[model samples]
Target: MKVVVDTNKCQDHGQCVFAAPDVFRLDEAGRLAYVSGPDESLRADVEDAADVCPLQAITLED
Candidate 1:
């Protein structure tokens, strides 16, 4: 699975972080950081993250 977060649309609100901590996180600078290519096992969690993103910044690709 592949994940992409649109930084321009993201507000650094950490919604994705809560939904999928393994794939999304806040860096030391408090900026949004994420794994572009996450394990397939984490697809469900990543999808949940994308669903919960208020800005709809998360996109998933097979």
Candidate 2:
């Protein structure tokens, strides 16, 4: 699966990090960072992360 986060809408919120630590995180500058393509096994977690994002900046694609 592919993960996309819209930086313009993201506000450095770490919800995605908690929901999917293996795929998303905060950089040293406290900005949002993530793996664009993660293993298929992680789809559920990635979906949860997208659901929890307060700004709804996360997108998933096959």
Best by lDDT: 2
- Writing each residue's lDDT as its tens digit, candidate 1 over 10-48 gives 999898899999999999989999999999999999999
Candidate 2, residues 2-54, lDDT tens digits: the string is: 89899889998899999999999999999888899999999999999999999
lDDT of 2 at 20: 97
In angstroms, what RMSD does candidate 1 have relative to the true structure?
Answer: 0.7
Error of 1 at 9 (Å): 0.5
Residue 16, candidate 2: how far off, in angstroms?
A: 0.2
The ten-residue window of minimal lDDT in model 1 covers: 1-10
Candidate 1: where is the Cα deviation over 4 Å?
none
Error of 1 at 1 (Å): 1.0
Q: After superposition, how far is residue 5 of candidate 2 from its true place, in Å?
A: 0.7
Error of 2 at 26 (Å): 0.4
lDDT of every model, 2 decimals: 0.93, 0.95
TM-score, per-candidate, Cα-based: 0.94, 0.96
